[model samples]
Target: MTVRNLPPVSELTEQQQRGWSCVWCAAPLSTGTAINLGEQRHEPAFGSPYWWFPRACPDARACAKREVTGDRR
Candidate 1:
């Protein structure tokens, strides 16, 4: 979806809300999902309407890398 015409996060349907996740990383997202609404100058397929969860947090990789990186503060 294009970010310029994307429906507001508040207007998302229940299914959409429940399905919200990082397409790339399969990360669970909440209302806390970061938003950057603006133009659609970039390719829409690259995640125009992106919602990112912190990569530095307790993700799948983090568990494996914890020994080296320790907990992200």
Candidate 2:
């Protein structure tokens, strides 16, 4: 199994960059108001590779934690 991650905004494809709202905080996205969190790809053998594009709001801070396994929120 292998996983591929997307590049920064400058290297993102046009389709990948097409977003009117932020993927993280639901903020208006534009050339000047977007925080590119890059894209990611989850590879699977059963179907097409799942592609994910995450964009953060201007006021949002960057943080990362381990993936939650169950209902811990």
Candidate 3:
């Protein structure tokens, strides 16, 4: 699976961080239909590394379409 570069955690919503929504388009996702982006580790300058599980829509093209069309806020 191609692991695309993820957006910064700080820019993501809590739902995105928890893998409940598409990381790119912020669409709702079900486990069976979502593509797991894998575990992400964020190392801060002053603290321990934080781990996050990210997922995206199965159809990346659609997600990108939504993003480009401004369907997602």
The local distance difference test score of each candidate is 0.35, 0.46, 0.88
For model 3, the superposed segments whose C-alpha errors exceed 4 Å read none
Residue 34 in model 2: lDDT: 64
lDDT of 1 by residue, 1-73 (tens): 3222333444444333344432223344444543323222223445556442222122435433542454322
After the best TM-score superposition of candidate 3, give how far the Cα of residue 24 lies from its true spot, in angstroms: 0.5
The TM-score between candidate 2 and the true structure equals 0.42
- Model 2: ten consecutive residues of lowest lDDT: 63-72
Tens digits of per-residue lDDT for model 3, 1-73: 4667899988999999999998989989988999998899988778788898899999888889987786873
TM-score of 3: 0.85
Give the per-residue lDDT digits (tens) of candidate 2, residues 8-61. 544444444555455433344566766666555656557777666665445433
* Highest lDDT model number: 3
**Per-residue lDDT for 3 in model 1?**
24
lDDT of 3: 0.88
Highest TM-score against the true fold, candidate? 3
**Residue 18 lDDT, candidate 1, scale 0-100:** 40
Pairs that collide in candidate 2 are none
